[model samples]
Target: MRQSLRSPQQHCPARRQPLPVRNRVHRAWPVAGVAALAVITAGAFTTLAGLLVGPLHREFGWSRSTIGLASSVNMVLYGLTAPFAAALMDRFGMRRVVGTALALVAFGALWTTVMTAPWQFVLAWGVLVGAGCGSMALAFAATVTQRWFVRRRGLVTGVLTAAGVFGQFAFLPLLSRVVERFAWRTAALTLVVAVTVVLPLVLLLLRDHPADVGVRAYGAGEFTARPASAPGAARRTVRALLRSARTGPFWLLAATFAICGASTNGVMWTHFTPAAHDHGMPATVASSLLAMIGVFNVVGAVASGRLTDRFDPRRLLAAYFALRGLTLLALPLLMTATAGPPMVTFVVLFGLLDVATVPPTLALCRELYGGDSAIVFGWVGAAHQLGAGIAAFAGGAARDAFGSYDPLWVGVGALCGAGALLALTVVRPSRT
Candidate 1:
């Protein structure tokens, strides 16, 4: 079991020694960097997939739906990996779990460089990369906030979650250029190098618990013991999942998040460039637009965090879903052969709502799951990805079947409308 750090203030009055001023500085800030690195490393692959779709289709003669199946596997495994990873983090350590995940990401990328068949792509990108990325998903952010800090958790969660956007926007434009200039193998190699670069930082800088440094979480006035893990962590995961399955709140939260994942990762991230290409925009232009969206996502995600800290999370979530649905509804009408004012407006507005769902969703998890928030939230993440996986496959199939993406967009927008209503139904447990 991990040991807990005690604040100086919590020590016996007579035995207390002064805590060095620097020691009390929140260590979570640096830990957040490590967490962000993991997310960024995972996100690099996710952001680049859209650019790869058209190229893969042209070179391999694979249909868009065939390529999307790989993405579907990736999304499904990504979601399924989270809760198990959280349990492992509790049993092993952050450094071990994170390091292993990164290695898997690197290896998955390396394997993708040599793929000659669709099944190989599915195994590498879908199973391996998806599992690796899922291991470091928002659950890592949740783990960091819960274990490393007592105050400012919302703010940190927001920043860490925004790291996904940063990874996308910062890298997507450049990567689109890379794909334009080089073979897909070069792009796969780039992911290998990028994921490998963060491994050392994670190994050297990250600690599983603040107690490793002999200081309490920032603003904590007393020591709290880390809870012991169950003898069988896999069994524990099943139990927590079964218990959460029985709760009305869990189903409501999961349903909303499924819509969230379908909207963001499933349709938009996977198909946005191709969808734009359908209207005669270049892939590079679409990626740059996505990069722009990433910039605004930072602002929106951070503001959402602050709002969640002070406001009713359910209302914030409802507003976010409603606004997102409206923007998506407007998207079909705004499509033009080239970048224009309407497209620009959609990018800006949707960017602000992009990952804005994260902070409020996480806040609600804390309220709902209490002590098991991290692991329970992991299951919710799975539901989100399950939706993404289904949507990713279905969106591509729709494009193939109908020769247009319009139907997919309309269906997803309507689902978002349903999600907004569902968000309001989330019952907050009364505070004692």
Candidate 2:
């Protein structure tokens, strides 16, 4: 009996198995799809702020500056919240953090519909939505790609970044019409419904790590255990910032990204519709043009991602920034009361350039910082928002003071030129 038992034990199978077949679709893709959807939803809220400017000003007799102040607050908090959100993902898990963010966004949208005062608007739109969207910002994309993918990281990052901008600009035409035909409250309510629908999907489908699903990250050669959740999310975030701050690349990335924010999110996203309206285009037409930009942004960002995988990301950054600057400089000449050929040309080119910088920037962060890339990129993103907040307010103030957005465009264009030069100066970290 003992001899028979020994024989059976010796014949038992080994515990480990070969890595799963590559032919099968990885779970990462589906997770990425959900992440993209979440980002798109968050982006819709970000761009929705621009649309509210006109309606609020008209309805409440608030000045453009006052509306812009709320936008500035939103943009600032949106950026400031990213690093913490990233760290929170590490501590709490992506599913929980993201779901909470969606909830906050939904609540903020609902609150906006009922607010009567400027402070109330700022509290609802600025603080809550900003924090919510910030948590879902590009850093969220970076975290997902890094954690769930070991291949095609750049491509995935580009797609997610594009999703955000696509969400922002794509819905503008419909939302603008809603505001024009019905009321701004109707538009806010619409956002609440959209966000609420996405929340449950996220809670159900989104997983914290690849290991959670009995798989490794897509393209990983072998399975590895998920890292232990670090204690103190806030402490980790601060420590990451402190360590990264010592590096020259961090500052350069932050500065360039700030300009990126100022030019794109600040001046363009926030003020373009109002500026176009000022020049003679109807709100719906202006929004349609913006929507076209959103469509092409997907193309540009994805193409840039593919390129980043193959080329030197630094060079790509230089080219993208320089071209963006030139395009912004030409905007005043191209923008007219009507959607002329010149304006359309500007829209096509600008849309293509809009968020293309993100993939390369994220790649640079990964290349330079390795494991700390997500947190570092979060800080860089905060700078982007800082620039955006300043530009959003400045653009509004400039409009109120000077009666035109032309000067603001010219100023931001010049800054983009500086950003191009700054991109070239980022030094690659030495691999020991």
Candidate 3:
């Protein structure tokens, strides 16, 4: 039998080879890495309010309700602004959108220093800071996770979401010390400086897409195409809302997130320090407890992300909400003048639940909505903020009316129970 010596060119056409992880022109992790740091800096404005509210009340002779109204406005704007921020990021690029947001945060923090009246506080903290921070909200984490990593989306989401925990945990003690030692103005100045510093970093390192650095998303075998530029952001937002409103899952997710925001940002982050004060704890000690929660939250959030990659997200969310509810029910008992085992245990448990909801929630959004995940999550985030804003105001009002945060805690715990039931009801799509 004649062995036919075919020319080498007669072989089947070469298959496209994936670029090696090391030899790839650009990597996704660097972009995600920079984003994580920028996110931490962006969050500086959020945690200080609990510490500042008391000082502002004392210095300006304002009511707790009045101070809380400003925080409410901030939360509302933070939620309301997210869809547009997502839109802006889609159309204009991440660097420009985030850069502009940082500028707004700096201006607001700086402007807050000279505020002499309640209305000025509203304008600076409520309007400016709210809008600025909202523009850089958790949607950024979702956006980056979806765009940068195919293999570790859940884990990355967890880490990025933990950035918020880092901001609150790492900074609250320091900010409380600053407020106690100097004027509240000094604390505001610190926020301005921090945001200003992050601005240069965003410009220098952040890119809108992996292609901008010449590589595919991590684990993907090829480059993905850029999405079409968004239409008028306001118009797109309205349209997306209208379309998403027709779905049951959208409402379910939104409702659950609202509870999340109400429980965490609205009630706890905004009032926990003062509530602890009611039980005889000093501001420093209260802030330390909150900071400790943040530390554990980092662990919980990261772990949740890895879990989300492996388990049913809906189940994880249900368990997280139920656990959080139990913790909230126990919180009042632990509120004491001196730090003790009970309080320490509460901090650890609650911190693990804090922001751990984010990874599973985002994973579900991405799985369900595909390309629209960022915007859908943005609207859901709006619900979260709305709940947070309302809770902030309502908690203050409740405290004023009853002279205790007991009612607020009980009410939020009930809401968490409802959220757990809702999370379990979500119609999960089969994982591919």
Candidate 4:
């Protein structure tokens, strides 16, 4: 009450009260919370693209490689856009960046309904949609970490990371059914409508930092006064940031994230829907499988976050890559009967492992790289997308040739094992 500072919102009462425990989670309205909302939006759109893959293939008879390319471009552009998003968020308030991104995403998804060819797909789903989601995405994660939290960062991150998974889990089935009954165009348009619903939610509730509303953070449950950053720190020029990006941890984080992209979105998002269909699974059933994996992605990612808090992040990284590699190797065989117990088991196991690597990767970025963490994560995630982009094309090619995803499973698993070794050798930080 003794001091006043400029903030994004002036409407809040000077004496803000604590949120009741149940509502406290909402009160945090924290970056993690915003990230969760963005995750749902991103996941829905991402999985919507996958759900459409099967129907689009059936409608146009485009080769897998061709369809994969569209998703490839999306992932590539998505990853490529990450660092800029982080930088932009750093420069502006999270509210402007995320809300604008959501609006763009909804526009892109809606526009996809009218596409007549590959180029149209590329313009809508690949470029605009991907970039939009990528921008706001872990924005929540990065923003929350840097501002509202100093402890339990990994746990908060896990919840946010898990949001995308839940979105995929919850949205894919509904989308698949829409595709089954209406058409691929309907699915895309439906997403446009769905994303429209989240826009107001984002605009009204989201804020860049707790200070913006004349309040201290929620969970810390104490109102000690401190500026979120040093004066002028938030407005630092890009040159200062680029200079920092060249540090060692920058490359390490980007490399690990590239591996992350290759292992997850590269194969799963682009191929899984069609692969499930190819194996004789109905679209609805396949969607259920995808959702089941999302359920486990939440569980696994949360567990990884907890472990990240307790263990050496690098060791945890190694284990995640190795175990994920093993899972990839086993999947082609296990996911065979789309309607059986094996399929269920595969979904459960794979989903659990799906985004589990994320918390560790992001946690390590913050722990090792410090102030440059989000931008570092951005570059690393770009690598992840780059890998996914390559694998997206390759997975399609292997399937077209061998008439099975078996070869890709083995190859991707090997890549994951190599990634595990890389995680092992990730150098530790010395005292800065």
Candidate 5:
């Protein structure tokens, strides 16, 4: 009777011992830092296409449309390779895939320095660099957030997306100055050096899963085991595309993202500097304006990420698209020979809206698809690149034929309005 009356705690005193303390700073944050660095480095190459168009035209007498064709190839490959790369990441791990991508970029940039023909440009810049950049695209960010974070996922996604855009735009002024002061070959070589420096850092720091470092994903209550590496990465990629293609949301997302790519990468990035030149603006000044958009983009993307965590993502996308459409429609009036206050305002507003679409779009992918969101996003990203490629070529051709980019601007603006409407139609799946 005395023993029975004793408390259960007396029988198992070990159970009352304090649990092991977790680290004050999670390893996920450091890993995310490294990933962002890699993304930024990869993104540094994107604007090179725009910056080189004038220099190449002056030296080689290649038509603007020809250089635009190469850029179109680059954009298309950059988009198409994303889904496959995401699958490859799942199978091989992030470090290896990203490192390999960096190597390809370095090689491609080096190759561009020596190429003499249009096909060589197509092969080096269009194929190799495009594929390399694609491997390190927005899909990589989605994968990092999916695997390493359970909390602040939206914020991290936004930061990483912004990192890529930052790399693309921020380096423009520097590269433009380099091209003006040195040769285009020197600018390409500079890119090669940047990529080579980043490759080792990625291999040394990037881990495939949180489990590799003996920590649970950030905010997870218990340690989660790493999943076994699945084989047939190509098959997995195809299967994902096939399954997602059957769904209504996938098509809507693809269509809107395509418009996103068209409006941003295809028209603006590929043509903005040349168009500014067409208006008598100095190349360096135009590049600086583009860089300004890059700087503010970081602020916009991170803020959008924070908002994504709190607000309805669909509404956020709808608003972003609408605002962006209005801005693009007004861009023609702002293009002058110099950067005025009105031009600066346009740059700031456009920069803020530049990649803001990414975070909410990723959010919707995860919310709708659950475990397969990253893969689904890859397919969606492909659509984005396709739209961008078409727009890039079309913008160049329009300028060559009609002697102005005004019509292209107005066309893309209308398409963005369509994207806004599409964003509203994406409803969450109903529960049983």
Candidate 6:
């Protein structure tokens, strides 16, 4: 078995220590750089998809089902790759993996500018973007949690995740306006430029660990023994996480996170525009509302991040699911384009729980999996994407079938209730 890191709050060997113990602090630059890259990349791809949805639909005459499938493919792959990517990071290093992933994203985005058919678009933009992002997704999140100061792990995760939501919120609208002003192809090319611009800064600023620079982990009172793996090579870190699968608490965490995915990005992100359109809301207006969802998602995610350090992650997850379900169920009753109580009520409540589960879910992964926490969380993240894939496609398919998203709204609400049960009853101290 691979060796675990030194126990929490432990210090490194004497010769390896950077400066006097008192001078060691987790440098902020590397993690900040990673977070910045995450925000821009996630924001760019999500916005690009939104802007292209109209153009692709108009150009190809493909049904919404066809378009939704592409996103589903992308999301599933994105989540599935996370564990492997984390494994790879453990082997190689973040600098190479992240840089390569960014390059792939850039290649995929630019390649889409030349596609003449829907499948071509799917393969290039959907698959490649998913692949690129898959390698980059929760790897960054894991690194932030593992490498940052312990007391601030929750806060760090929240802030980093918020960068992703902000990307969705801010960039989609900006790109929407850009697509309005320019062709969709031009809008896509712009993203390629943006990713390329960020790559250099990442290479220059990011180091996989503080130890590389002759320092202990950020705020770690003690450090663990380093593993024997090469500085940068991909391995089956996911297999490491499977050890926890035999237990109940891990299952509870997986199930709850799957619901987390289904409830938020799976349904809300995928179906919001079409659902709003069902009620006669224009697509762009619906998009703005979704972007608004990103805003509150940022808030909820940040708050949850702070909360994870103090509260039982299970309680936080259970509460998030209960609240999310209630809000989703209320949507058919509450949502509208106009500025009114039901609409505002829907926005405020649902938005609060949008991404609130992330911190607690991640914290619980560490609790349950211990030394293999990063890899375990990667698999859990994979479960989230799988739920996202199914729900994303299902939401679109439901819209295509029944002409509204009411059934999915109800179904997701029910799943959330199930998730709450799993969180409250199944989660135990050693199980995580």
Runs of candidate 6 with Cα error greater than 4 angstroms are: 1-26, 222-227, 230-235, 430-432
Q: What is the TM-score of each candidate against the true structure?
A: 0.94, 0.94, 0.93, 0.88, 0.94, 0.88
lDDT of all predictions: 0.87, 0.92, 0.88, 0.76, 0.92, 0.75
- What local lDDT does model 6 show for residue 80? 79
Clashes of each: 0, 0, 0, 4, 0, 14
lDDT tens per residue, model 3, 305-384:
99999999999999999999999998887787999998898889999999999999998888778787888899999999
Better of 3 and 5 by TM-score: 5
Q: Report RMSD for candidate 6.
A: 7.5
The alpha-carbon deviation from the true structure for residue 265 of candidate 4, after best TM-score superposition, in angstroms, is 0.7
The worst-scoring run of ten residues by lDDT in candidate 3 lies at 12-21
The segments of candidate 3 whose C-alpha lies over 4 angstroms from its true place after superposition are 1-26, 430-432
lDDT of 1 by residue, 61-145 (tens): 9998899999999998989899888888988877898899999988988988888899999999899989989999988788889
Candidate 6, residues 1-432, lDDT tens digits: the string is: 123455332554665565666454356546665656755575568555645656677887888778888888888888877887787777777778888888888888888888877788779877888888877776567765686456677887887777776676666666766777778888888788888778888788777776666656656777645556554333456356658788777777878888888887688777776677667776677667777877887788889998888888888888888888888887887656553667766877877787788888888778777767887887888788889889988987887898778999999999999998888875556443
Tens-digit lDDT track for model 5 on 277-312? 889999999999999999999999999999999998
Q: Pairs clashing in candidate 3?
A: none
Alpha-carbon lDDT of model 4: 0.76
Using lDDT as the yardstick, the better of models 2 and 4 is 2
Whole-model lDDT, model 2: 0.92
- lDDT at 290 for candidate 6? 70
Candidate 1 vs 4: which has more lDDT: 1
* Order of candidate numbers by lDDT, starting with the best: 2, 5, 3, 1, 4, 6
